[model samples]
Target: MAGGLLGTDVVTQIGIIVRDIEKTSQAFADFFGVEKPKWFLTDTIDKTQATYRGEPCYGRAKLAFFKLGNLDIELIEPDEHPSTWREFLDQHGEGVHHIAFVIQGMQEKITLLAGRDMPLVQKGEYTGGRYAYIDTVPQLKVAIELLEND
Candidate 1:
């Protein structure tokens, strides 16, 4: 608790994993009458990987970004890869993956979380942004992303 923080305590950006990124993104747009969000295929993603339980795995995914009422909504379509998202989708279709939070003092947060022995599910840089997924739920669990310039 010293270096880490409660997810609820952080202002969050919610991302929903869906069977179809286009469909879900449109749904949000239609409901709010907002413009359709831009889409991003896995090929376009700056980085892509999977996590099985909490280790490196292989898979494909489609992602998109949109803005609604100051909230950035992301649609993720997990491929048949062995990723945490894939597991979630397999068990529960498409749904909320994580409540992402952008933080200042990011490197500090990373060190703090690591110092506490939290296992990282995935870590990498993409599209000029650096991010890490920490499975704070037990040893291997859901990820809380610290996306920079997201």
Candidate 2:
């Protein structure tokens, strides 16, 4: 609720899990009357160094993004690997996965959230930034993603 935890209250992105990113991305484009965004695969383990529940995970996903105003709508199609995305899609089916906030200190935020019972589920690095998913469903009914850009 306060900047003390997340550094800011502004949500920059909303990620949705889907079985087929191409189809879903088109759906969004049609509904919004925007250009269909191309979907791409996330970085590999060598590049991302992704982890799941504190263990190295080789999971990767296809991602497509649509920017509207200041918010981005992300569509994710997870591979059959161990990851927060895959787990969410398996347990809850395709739907909203996480709401992301751009933050400063990712480790500190992750620690603070963990202290409040929101444990880190998965984490990985992107081209110019990093991301972490926190299991906040128990309290917020949705996972929270922390994005730190370099």
Candidate 3:
């Protein structure tokens, strides 16, 4: 269970696509009785990188994260950039986009999924780590994000 690839039955974060981060973050904070979460602009992300359908691509989004007990609730406001967030908002409207798992062997997990036909849809690097969103809808019913935190 510890080293297995995610979507083998584990979820670390619940990500929701929203239209407005300020409004939605405040709403969720108010409802959960917690302080407003800090929002991060994807524009500031370092080592930024992405791909769509196996081709190089780019996207921007505003994100906020709130802790709810042991799990995290993430809100994403897709900007004009072409990204998974934008795609989800465009196709499905605002809703749950994906469940994430912090993995140890990031590339290994990605390769395993890729072997099974789950192509990497988006990827980017931040301060201490990187993340990749896999198009795993066919089997998992939702995308799965693999994170490697330093």
Number of the top TM-score candidate:
2
The CA-based lDDT of model 1 is what? 0.66
Two-way TM-score contest, 1 vs 2, winner: 2
lDDT of 2 by residue, 1-150 (tens): 577578798999999999999889999999999999989999899999999999998999999999999999999999998898899899999999999999998998899999999999999899999999999999999999999999
- Return the clash pairs for model 1, or none: 59-81
Each prediction's TM-score versus the true structure = 0.71, 0.97, 0.88
All candidates' lDDT scores?
0.66, 0.93, 0.83
lDDT of 3 by residue, 124-150 (tens): 777788889999999989998888899
Candidate no. 1 TM-score: 0.71
Model 3 gets an lDDT of: 0.83
Clashing residue pair totals per candidate (backbone < 3 A): 1, 0, 0
- Rate residue 128 of model 1 by lDDT: 56
lDDT of 1 at 34: 83
Best by lDDT: 2
Displacement of residue 33 (Cα, Å) in model 3 is 0.9
In candidate 1, how many clashes are counted?
Answer: 1
